[model samples]
Target chain A: MPYSETAREEQPRTPSLTIDALGKKCPIPIIWLAQRIGEVPLNAVVAVLADDPAAYTDVPAWCRLKSHPHVGTYELPEGGWSIHVRRNY
Target chain B: MLSAVEHSAVLHAAGVHERDGGAVSAVGVSRTGAVRVDAFAEAVAVPGTALACLQTANHEVGTLQPVAEVAAACREAGVPLLVDAAQTAGRLPLPEGWSVLTASAHKWGGPPGVGVLVVRKGTRFRSPLPEDEREGRRVPGFENVPAIVAAAAALRAGLAEEHEQERLSALVDRIRRTVPRVVPDVEVIGEDEDRAPHIVTFSCLYVAGEALLTELDKAGFAVSSGSSCTASTLRPSHVLEAMGVLTHGNIRVSLPRGASAADVDRFLEVLPGIVRRIRQEAGVSS
Candidate 1:
């Protein structure tokens, strides 16, 4: 409940799952990604749309901890980022 | 030492301990940013431990550690305890049972580069440098006589004006309670009570800490930040991270002696707008 609500976003990468944490805060964006990572199948690309400064680092750190491949992070036209992660089961 | 939130001084001291072939133990910190004193007692009780060090109070979050209890634990375990009272010296009473204590002069409104190191009677200590006649051979260099006298005067003056502390404490309390209500999506780092009177810290959600700091500075608020974006390390300060608190957009406000109530109120007034502006620039809706 502390985290902001999530929505889906369309990215050029066409991730299988998109977690929208656009206006959310630090650990919340990280929380959204961790909570919804299981929704997509293994090896699926999950895109996290976040603008939180902390999420820029936390997302990659979370991926490293979970052993998921952090594919890449791309800038968005609307001032945030789209981080693509490949969940490696 | 409590590694989770110690100032870098202790961290580097830990490095020295390792080089000296002594195993240094760290106590975990609670989410409120205080060290786990019970675990620290156990760590001190470990066999072959030579000395344990603890801070009089946490510098970042202003939370006071249970130094007396910890020092007692170290004593019972037969380990000498060093209390780093840099932040609380002259501001608060000294904690009991410390074998050695250290303080910084500038921290108490005195000239910089003057430090106070006191070893309690019967405490075994030797200068790492070659023995000298200066200060009972504990210090190697010639002491700065004027600076030391000025530092003592400043400390005495600070302790004399103890009533000013109540006013500063109130101001800090105002910041602690009002920051969240005024600025949307703000998380105050430490508790309202049981903290150093002069300090308060908070983090704004979705706002870059440096950006916030710049705006606040432009508005005449000279504050410090612990957020990773503000530092060259490119990582959040270990204190906030260890406590699992918001690490970005963090601001630490330390009121100087005789800080005004009107200034604090104005800070509360302008903070929301600053946070909003930063969030907007970041494309955050809130």
Candidate 2:
């Protein structure tokens, strides 16, 4: 639960909500993303930061499965990734 | 009863049977993909356990189960154990204390439609399905005699080339050792020492298994992958999941008898580039 609303300076895509789940395993980041997607306003970019290998492909897969638009993934300065998804109803 | 890492043939076979109030519990496997024999020992010692099943070696990862230990426990509890030796029928020696055994012919280059079933004397077995009232006999119906002969011949031939195990094990060890070194964000899975010789598995981070497999196939290497985004299954491989390893981007390489070291070397050479390309296409970097 390392989520935070950054001061719009951390990423290329400005995500209104960022769920930071660094160092977590597979499906946890996906689960957190699914659980919190409704919180953001419509068409807002919600970012989930996860390091598990499965999330690299599965986040896009979740979008394909749930019909959500995958905004794209961005590599962090350190390790892991910041996966972004647009909240589309 | 079954274990968490039994072959899907066993898992689905066990699953398809009609069960009414018959509780089935899957004994979990250790992190090394070996079945937790101590946990299994406790499960079988419980009274009223009908039958227990275990695979000879995992088909995905090459971890060999503690069949000898678990079989001793089953013997103590007076429960019958059925071993599915489809992966190791001709390749490895059968584990002792198995009351019954089953193997698929195609696994050892035999006819696809044939299977072998061996039920030891005095072991109680009643087919869950309604008995086919064709004939009163130990085995009924005309068997595929030609396919059966071919399967037997294949098994014998496969056994004769047992020396290949050493060469294959070396190659397997090579992959087990080299994959992680060559490919970044890769995890080589399964038991190193107590494993069957032919199989090796590894998972790559930030790559889809299907895309990697397709690219490998295009590069003229025949291999299998266990990933959720693939064709058939929508979930990651249960074996890798049970082992608690990286589930996606999984590749399982099974070296056939008389497999060439040069082919394996070529695979090792080409594999890193393929994984990198797949990662690039998936928009992932590791």
Q: Give me the overall lDDT of model 2.
A: 0.79
**lDDT, candidates in the order shown:** 0.79, 0.79
Candidate 1 chain A has its poorest 10 consecutive residues by lDDT at: A1-10
Cα lDDT tens digits, model 2, A1-89, are 00111123334578999999898765467657777889999989998898775666556656644667777777788888888888888
Cα lDDT tens digits for candidate 1, B177-203:
898788876778775688888989987
Model 2 over residues B1-286: C-alpha lDDT tens digits? Answer: 8788888777767666535445777888876788988889899988888889999998888888888998999999999999889878887889998999999999898989898888899998665444555433345566688999999998888878858788899999999999989998677888998898899988776566777788899999888888322338555677776766666677889998888999999999999999887766655544
DockQ of candidate model 2: 0.07
Candidate 1 lDDT: 0.79
Chain B TM-score of every predicted model: 0.96, 0.93
Residue B104 error, candidate 1, Å: 0.5
Query: Which residue segments of model 2 deviate by more than 4 Å?
Result: A1-17, A20-89, B18-21, B129-140, B227-231
Q: What is candidate 1's CA lDDT for residue B142?
A: 89
lDDT of 2 at B199: 93
State the weakest 10-residue window (summed lDDT) of model 2 chain A: A1-10
Can you list the residue pairs that collide in candidate 2? none
As a TM-score, model 2 comes out at 0.76
TM-score of chain A of each: 0.83, 0.84
